[model samples]
Target: MTKAITLRADHGSDDLRRLARASRDAAQTRRLLALAAIYDGASRTEAARIGGVGLQIVRDWVARFNAEGPAGLVDRKAPGKSPRLGPEQRVALVQAVEAGPKPESHGVVRWRLVDLVRWMQDRFGVSVSRQTLGRELRRMGLRKLSARPQDQAQDPEPLEAFKKTFPPSWRRSASSCPRKPLELWWQDEARVGQKNGITRRWARRGTRPRAPHDQRTTWAYIFGAICPAKGKAAGLVMPYANTEAMQAHLTEISAAVEPGAHAVLILDQAGWHMSTHLAVPENITFLPLPPRSPELNPVENIWQYMRENWLSNRVFENYDDIVAHCCDAWNKLLAEPTRITSIGFRTWAHGS
Candidate 1:
């Protein structure tokens, strides 16, 4: 016959009562109640009944409590399998990954899971499963990364030099006077898609009208300058985007700004804006935006509106059609200076 078990008041003081009261979760409350009952001179079976758990679970808890004290009764570490790769093997695996794949022996463009497995087998004479290798890679913080061929061949010197010399600042001289008039100026480029389509509904009940499709054409590039306060704008549509094309666009913008007493031309860090090929005019000052921050440009919102409202649904047959439509949209935007100013000041409101 099995020996009869007796419970004793093992928990010191009234701490278990406080724990039972403080426990919010149902499972935790039950566990604390069971422990409290066991501590209050109840049998294991009696404690299990009060706790609403099995007798075996109560006995297990008591055994754990006796073995490793109160912490042992709370929870134990999960039983998990040990890692296959030893410390030395793990270090070797990291070294192999850092060295990259050997193309001559592996006969592959890049390293794959199977290739890694094979490489490890041949190089270290240790056979490792694909799953094990993947786990090891993950443990070592290795992630899938791609490299472009051009990125490998790029020279950093020219880019560094260009960064250093461009955008030279000139302080206002004491003798210099402000120009004719002051205007809030904005300069930006927009792309026109030559091939575009529009969807329409027909009068017939069951069928929808299909719009014409034009695939051979593309959108014209429009470089525009606008005054927010006066609602006046000047723009030039061109075939391509380059320093020469931008210089031509700037020529037109310079004439417009010539009448303004103060002009601030807000433009992005495009290649044309920073190119050494063009000379910076004295009257017109270029306000360079921080790199890659397109959200700060209000002209972006104008282009977004233009695309969604006017250009999105309509289909154009050729470049000429695209240019005409874009010019019309540009004129319409110029007519609404408040809208432009509101959109431009979006970031400004948020302390950008």
Candidate 2:
């Protein structure tokens, strides 16, 4: 014999009705409707039909509601379904990923999701989904990145020694002139052409924007220098990136500064930059970066910014158009000294 189920003393027909209306959870709404129907004197069979569940399920739900109220009727994770990795296990997993897998032992070049899944099970008797492993990796500051390999034989001591002594060494004679603050300019050269290179862009989902590859072959080398200390920039476009062009760029940079004011120029040890006929101006001093260390150059980032923004995915009709577009981009960049300062300033640079 099934006893009649009634609403609790604190709750009325209005309360049950409100619960059914307010609940966003469809499963919770169904349970509430069933309870409401029973309170309205409906039979058990009728309540089951209204709740869209079998009579036995409805009975089970009624028992839960009676034991724990509305909260009891809400869905819950199944028992023993919690994550396999505990806090300590998670920390261990992070450490293992950071160390990276040994190719000799792991028999793999890199850690893929499946590879990690197997590794976890082997190391800790834990089973984690690929998605779960990825989330854990991200939490521990791991990310997918393009790696540029450096030679193991190359020594980094020289680069370290150069950065250590550069700043205070320059400041010794940098502020001698009153007209200009110490203008520390980092210089780099880039080639802009008709085929500017492909980059990502927003488009309709499941569709790709195809660009015509019939771009002109002609290109021009652009030499640019950004002075963080003075919030200034100087650039020149030439047909070649040789000693003569570099000398011209250096002259242009030297001329842009206040008269009688000397400037410090940080540059990479490229052949053209070190050429005998480079003709470095008397007011400009060149500080060559360590070998194979373009990352230490702030001007390198400017090339990336230009390629990613104005030059990418653009097909110029002629060499003249490329020059015009590049000139416009540099003009826009030059007008925004704050942008230049923000992007160009490095901790090793004067005002960083």
Best by TM-score: 2
Alpha-carbon lDDT, every model:
0.67, 0.80
Regions of candidate 2 where Cα sits further than 4 Å from its true position: 1-81, 87-89, 92-115, 118-125, 145-153, 172-180, 203-217
Q: What lDDT, from 0 to 1, does candidate 1 have?
A: 0.67
Alpha-carbon error at 77 in model 2, in Å?
11
Candidate 1 residue lDDT tens string, 15-122:
666766775566555666777776666777788898777877877766665565455545446889777677887887787777776678668777788988887777
- Measure candidate 1: CA RMSD: 9.9
Model 2, 1-352: lDDT tens digits are 7675555666555677798788888898888888888888888899899998888888888888878888887899878767667899888877777787899999988789899999989988888899988987887788976454554665788767767877776666455454565567889998988766886778898998886554567898889998875678899988888998998898889888777677888888789999887777878877777887776777777777777777777778877887888888888888888878888787864524
RMSD (Cα, Å) for all candidates, in order, is 9.9, 6.0
Clash count for each candidate, listed in order shown: 7, 0
- In model 2, pairs of residues that clash are none
